[model samples]
Target: MNSVNSSQNNLLFTSRCPEVRDAQWVCQKVKNTFPHISTTKISAKMADIEEANWDLYRKFIDKPEYALLYNKNPKDRKFLRLFAWRRRIVKRIHDARESWRIGGKDDYHRVNNVLGQFKYDKLGNCGEDAFMAATILRINGVDNTCTAGLKVDGSFLDHMVCVFNKDGSTFNGKPNKNTIIIDPWVGMADFASNMFQKYKNVFSELLIGIKPQSEITFRNVDEVGISGMERFLLIMKHPELCYPNSAREFMRKK
Candidate 1:
């Protein structure tokens, strides 16, 4: 059974999806063209690459089969309990584990922070994708790039993305015009101020009854001060800590 599962996973990864291929192409193109660019040009070009990665990821997940399997529609809650949904979800989780294990041998149980591993596998949910996007930005000389996620009432809201502090300004209660957010999961990258509006207009279906910016605390993963392995173990033990929201509490307890 293990061998059969491994074979199936190998086929899944070996046969590159079109979206994954396109994302890799964009990454390679950026790497090739980046060296000849000026500082100002580099930022714009890097944004394009980040946007392209986000677009491809969106395409990958928006496919009917994939979307239906992971449907979040409130009306689908009953259907989700059905064996068909359970089987598919379980299979996906298994596949993700296999991919993570093979790609991240050094950190098998932790999030794959190595860029090469992510590029090779091209399979992860929001958190991993956010980490990949932030790493890409940093590698290309972008500063203050970090993974950020929302927290409400001391619990994580199950979303994360790459945030760029373009002007090194601290985020207070209000959105800063210079704050850029790149969400590969949702296929958007814009100023934090503009993104708040887009969150309502564009991502309303996914976000649903969006919380006010003041109520939503954006936690940067870098500030968590825990090793990836330790963070992973903490989340495994206290699943509430799986999201970025629980990081502060975990630190406080430490």
Candidate 2:
């Protein structure tokens, strides 16, 4: 049944959904084209353009969750520190493991839907976890993307990771000038160092980054050995996974 709308609950409904969707494209454009752009500049621009349309989006940006998640509250700065390594960040991951359930096999869900279940103290697989982390970072004015890769061949995603940019010359215990790979589930930041943590040699290949401006495309994702009924059930349960195949041929090319 359709529920009555009030100013308190109508913010999301009255706001144009396409505006937020297009806002993603705008953010992606900034990230891919000018990765070195200042976070303050990006945040300001997004606030002017996107925030005008979605009040809830703006509220999420101004929230103190980033500080709480990192266990550091900077009075002067609005956004969290980039690539700032804090002990509480790791502790948060470990604590989350205790509350979030290890979801069933092949149970993929979108970031928004997976986040909704969080109120019930439920969790999803690696992909869901990575996407949720990426969303939080994005809301906190951090540029991030959800990445996926295959295990071997004709198999589901072997692992998922969130990629972001750090302004300084080093991050996550690496000499990266920009890119930093973060695995929210395992609390691993450096992929080169944590190769064996999630899966042995998972990053020995390439994985497409799902960012706002990304144009990566896929075909025949359902070519796996799973039966049609099983695949249909999985898709019905998690419609986001049915949108486009995450696997890319670049891994095989490498």
Candidate 3:
């Protein structure tokens, strides 16, 4: 990892780092467009951000297919069989999307990762939420703001979050005791320890059938090799690589 750090730094500087560039664009846009947000107290700003319902994007996109199946006769055995088959097909398509590898076929169902686009689309999953939150914090003068990824049970890279200095101090990669974590996906922001306790319950619910053993690890986007939009899409598609792991785990449990 140490040997790659230099190249990583170079990548972060050159055209290879569109994610970083996009984040900067978001910060600048927020600063220019929403200057009032930065003038408010930090707590107030965070609370205002918490009110946003961006997770609706996921809910909207994930609605099951074959809604007409629900209108079929409940008493008919054939209808039941066909409905069950439709459900299986829906689950299979979802699983295929989740398990898609980086170099596999192009993913047309990519989540909105371009942070600047969030202003207009108001649609995104955890990655977009984290990206926007971290950039907003920076625009609001939290110089230590960092977009972090979470690995559950030591393997599944299934969540994204924003970490920043609680006392408004600048720092490098990762968070310390002085840092606070803001998870826009769950609409909560608190000190690191408190946030994790709150998030554990939510995580358990989100990843049904896979009980997390309290093993949560965080990594900055730079450390994960997600340097561009294409890489971000690949990461987002796989539960073991990015957000919302429930479907994959549920299928595995069955």
Across 121-203, the per-residue lDDT of candidate 3 in tens digits comes to 32245664565566444333344566777765667666777766555565454456665666655555555654555556554
For each candidate in turn, give its C-alpha RMSD to the true structure in angstroms: 20.1, 20.3, 18.3
Error of 2 at 188 (Å): 2.0
Task: For candidate 1, write residues 214-252 as lDDT tens digits.
Answer: 244576455222344554454454342122343332112
Model 2 — which ten-residue stretch has the worst lDDT? 216-225
Off by over 4 Å in 1: 1-86, 98-122, 152-155, 168-175, 209-215, 223-254
Q: Give each model a TM-score.
A: 0.45, 0.29, 0.43
Q: Which should have the higher lDDT, number 1 or number 2? A: 1
Query: Top model by TM-score, which number?
Result: 1
Worst 10 residues of 3 by lDDT: 34-43
| Candidate 2 residue-wise lDDT, 26-99, digit = tens | 23432332122122223334445444535433443476465336544363222333222222343444455444
Would you list the C-alpha lDDT of every candidate in the order shown? Answer: 0.47, 0.36, 0.45
By TM-score, the better pick of 2 and 3 is 3
Model 1 Cα shift for residue 200 (angstroms):
2.2
**Which is the leading candidate under lDDT?**
1
Order by lDDT, highest first: 1, 3, 2
- Give the C-alpha lDDT of model 1: 0.47
Clashing pairs in 1: none
Better structure of 1 and 2 per TM-score: 1
Compute the lDDT of residue 147 as modeled in candidate 1.
Answer: 71
